[model samples]
Target: MEDNDQRLQRIKKLETLRQLGVQPYGTRFEVKDRAGDLIRLHGRKSKETLEQERIECTLAGRIVALRRFGKAAFAVLQDGADRLQVYLKKDLLGEQTYRICEELDLGDWIGVTGRLFRTKTNEFTVEVRSLTFLSKALRPLPEKWHGLTDVETRYRQRYVDLIANPSVHEIFITRSRIIAAIRSFLIERGFLEVETPMMHPIPGGATAKPFVTHHNALGMDLYLRIAPELYLKRLIVGGFPRVFEINRNFRNEGISTIHNPEFTMLEFYVAFADYTDLMGLTEELFVRLGREVLGRTVIDYQGRQIDLTPPWRRWSYHQAILEVNKLDESVLRDRSSALAAAKQLGVEVDPNAPLAAVLNEMFEETVEPHLQQPTFITDYPIELSPLARRKDSDPTLTDRFELYIAGREIANAFSELNDPLDQRRRFEAQASQRVAGDEEAHLVDEDFLRALEYGMPPTAGEGIGIDRLVMLFTNQASIRDVVLFPQLKPEK
Candidate 1:
C-alpha cells in the first residue's frame, strides 16, 4: 500500500504536467554521453580550461538526490556506475521548463543537455541548458541513513537493494566476470561447451534427493536434474572427447547459508585423463582465476587468507579423519568398530550403515570444517563412490578426490568407471540402498548403463559449485549473498 499523501501529491503533479502539454513518461531520449564518461574525460580540467573549451554533452540517468533554493537547484544523477551533479537555473531553462523541473522528485529518470563546468567547491558539475522527463517515481526511496538494512527485505526486493547499496552491484558484476573467466579458460584448453537436459527420467549423476514433477502427456514422473553428470558422460561415450556444461541443478534439500535447492554448477569431463590429472588441472584453473579476478594468488575469505598456489596437500579419506580426530586405524577398518567410534565422538550414524558410510560421517563432522586451506582428500572408499574407478593397488578404495577450501568442498572429481559389469554392481548397490530407505541414494539409470556398454574410454570428470566459487572470490559468507535471487518463503 502506498502512502496516500505522497501518492496524491505525485498524481497531482502528473495531472499538472498533462495540463501543460508535457508527457511525464517519455518514449526515447538520445543520450550522446554517459555521466561517468563525461566526468572521466573532463573531471581533471581546470575551471578556466572547461570554460574555454565549452564542452557540450547530453546524458540520461536516474535522479538520486535533489536540493532546491527558490529558482536554483542542484541534483545528482547516476548513470551506470557513475554519478554527476547537475545545476538548474530558472533563468537559463525559462519559466516553463523550470516549473517542470520543480515538479521533479528523486528517483525520476531524466535526460539533460548541458555544458561542463566546475563549482566553487572544485566539484565537477553539469550546467543544464534544457531538461526532459523520462519517468516518475510516485513513492520515495528508503531513508539514506538506515538504508535497506533488513536482510529478508534486501533479498526479496533486490532492485531496491541495488539502488540503495553500491556494494551489492559490484558483487553481481564480479559474478559475471568469474563466469566469463571460466569459459575463457575452458575454451582455450579445447573443451567444447555444450547443453544438457535439465529434466531426466532417472536422477543418477549424484546422490541427492531430487525435485520431482509429472509429465501430463506421458503420465510418468520426471525429475529436475541434480547434476548434469549423466548426460555429459553420455556425450563422452558418443565420442566427444572433452566437454563441459555450465548450468542449473535442482535438489530437494534443506536450505541453509551454504545450501540452495536450485543452484548453478560447472561439470566437465575429459577422455584419457585420470583423477590425478584433474587435480593438476583444477590447481591451474584456480590459480588462473585468482590472479585474473582478484589480482592475487592468495585471497582473504571470511578473514582467512587462503592461498591458491598449486600442489595443494593430498590425503586419503581415512588419513584425513585420523589427522583430525586421532582415531585408531582399526576403528575405521570395520563397520562395528567405526560405528562404535562414531558414537563415542558424538557423530550420528545409521546402525546398519557400512564401514565406509560411518567413516564418511565422522570425517564430514570432524575434518571438513578444519580444511581452511586448499587440500585434496583422495582415494575414497569404494562404497562411498559409485561411479569412480577402484584404485589398482587398493580395490577397496576408488580413484576419487574432493577439493576443499575455506572449510567447504568446492570440487569433486574421479576417474570414470568404464567397466559395464563393475558399473552394474555399483548401480545394484545404490538401488539396494534406495530400497532400504535412503532417499538420497542414486537410482539405477539403465539408459546410462546401456551407453556405458558401448565402451567409453578412460575418462575423468569434475563438478564445481559456481555459487560457492563466487562466494570465495567475492568474500561473501552466505550462498544467498552471491545468488541474485535465492529461494525464500513468501512474505507474510
Candidate 2:
C-alpha cells in the first residue's frame, strides 16, 4: 500500500505534467555514457580543467535524492549500480522549465544533457543544460538509510530490492560471472553445452518427488524434471562424448534455508572417465572457479574460512559413518543393527528400509553437518546408488562420491552404469520400491534402457546444485538470497 499523502502529491504532479502536454510515461532517451564511467574517467579532474574542456554528455537515470535550494537543486541520479549528482539551476532553465524541474519529484526517471564538472567538495558533478521527462514513478523508493530491510518484502518485490540494495545487485552480477566462468572452463576442456527437456516422461534420474503436469493434447502426464541425468546419458549413448547443461530442476519438497522447490543445476558427463577422474576434475574446476571468480583459493563463507585448494579430504561412506558415530563396521552392514543405531541417534528411517538406507539416514542426521570444509564422501552402497557403476573391488558399493562444503552437499558424481542387464535389474528394483509405496522412487524408463542397450561409454557424470554454489560464492546463508524469486506461501 502506498502512503496516501505521497500518492496524492505524485498524482498531482502527474496531472500537472499532463496539463503541460508531456507524456509522463516516456520512450527512448539516447545515452552516451554510464554515470559510473563518467566519474571513473574524469573524477580526479579539477573544476577548472572540466570547465576548460567543456565535456558534454547525455545520461538517463532515476532520481534517488533531491536537495532543493529555492531556485537551484542537487539531485542524485542512479543508473544501474552507479549514482551521480546533478546540479540544476533556475537561472539557466528560465521560468517555465524551472517550474517543470521544481515539480519533478524523487523516484522519477529523467534524461539529462549535461557538462561534467567537479564540485567544491571534490565530488564529480554534472551541470544540467537541459532535461527530458523519461518516466514517472508513482510510488516512492524505500527509505534510503534502512533500505528494503524486510526479507519477505524484499523477496516478494525483488525489483524494489534491487533498487534499494546494491549488494543484492552485486550478488546476481557475481552469479552471472561465475556461470560464464564455468562455461568457459568446460568449453576450453572440449565439452559442448546442450539443452535437455525440462519435462520428462519418467523421472528416472534421482529419488525425489516431482512436480507433475498434464499435456492435454498428448493425454498423458509429464513431470518437471528432478534431474537431467538420464537424458544427458542418452546423449552420451548417441556419441556426444563430453556434454553439459545448466538448467532448472523442480522437486516437490519442503522449503528451507538451503532448499528451493525450483532450483538450477550444472550437470555434465565425460566419456572414458571414472569417478576418480571426476574427483580430480572437480578439484580442478573448484580451484579454477575460486581463483577466477573470487581471486583466491580460500573464501570466507558464513564466518568460516573454506580452502578450495586441490586435494580436498576424501572419506569413504563407512569411514565417515564410523568416524562421526563411532559405530562398529558390522553394525552398518546389518539391517537390524543399523536400524537400532539410527533409532539411538534419533534419526528416522523406514522400518522396512535396507541396511544401506538406514546407514545413509544415520549419516545425514549425524555426520553431514560436521563436514564444514570441502570434503568428498565416496564408495556409497549399491542400494543407495542405482545409476553408479559398482566398485571393482567391492560389488556391494558403487563408484560414487558426493562433494560437501560448509556442511552441505554441493555436488554428486559417479561412474556411469553402462551394462544394459545391470541397468534393467536396477530399474526393476526401483519399480518394486515404487510399488511398495515409495513415492520418490525412480520409475523405470524403458527408452533409457533401450539407449543403454545400444551401449554408452564408460563415463563420469556429476550434478552440482547451482543455487547452492551461488550461495557459497556469495556468502549467502539461504538459497532464497541467491534466487531472484523463491517460492513462498500465498498471502491471505
lDDT of each: 0.91, 0.90
Clashes of 1: 0
Cα deviation in Å at residue 239, candidate 1?
1.1
Q: List where candidate 2 sits over 4 angstroms from the true fold.
A: 144-146, 350-352
Measured by lDDT, the strongest candidate is: 1
What would the TM-scores of all predictions be?
Answer: 0.96, 0.96
lDDT of 1 by residue, 420-442 (tens): 88999999988998999999988
Model 2 per-residue lDDT tens digits across residues 347-451 = 999998777778888889899999999999999999989999999999989999999999999999999999989999998998999999989987889999999
Model 2 scores a TM of 0.96
Clashes (backbone N, CA, C under 3 Å), per candidate, total: 0, 0
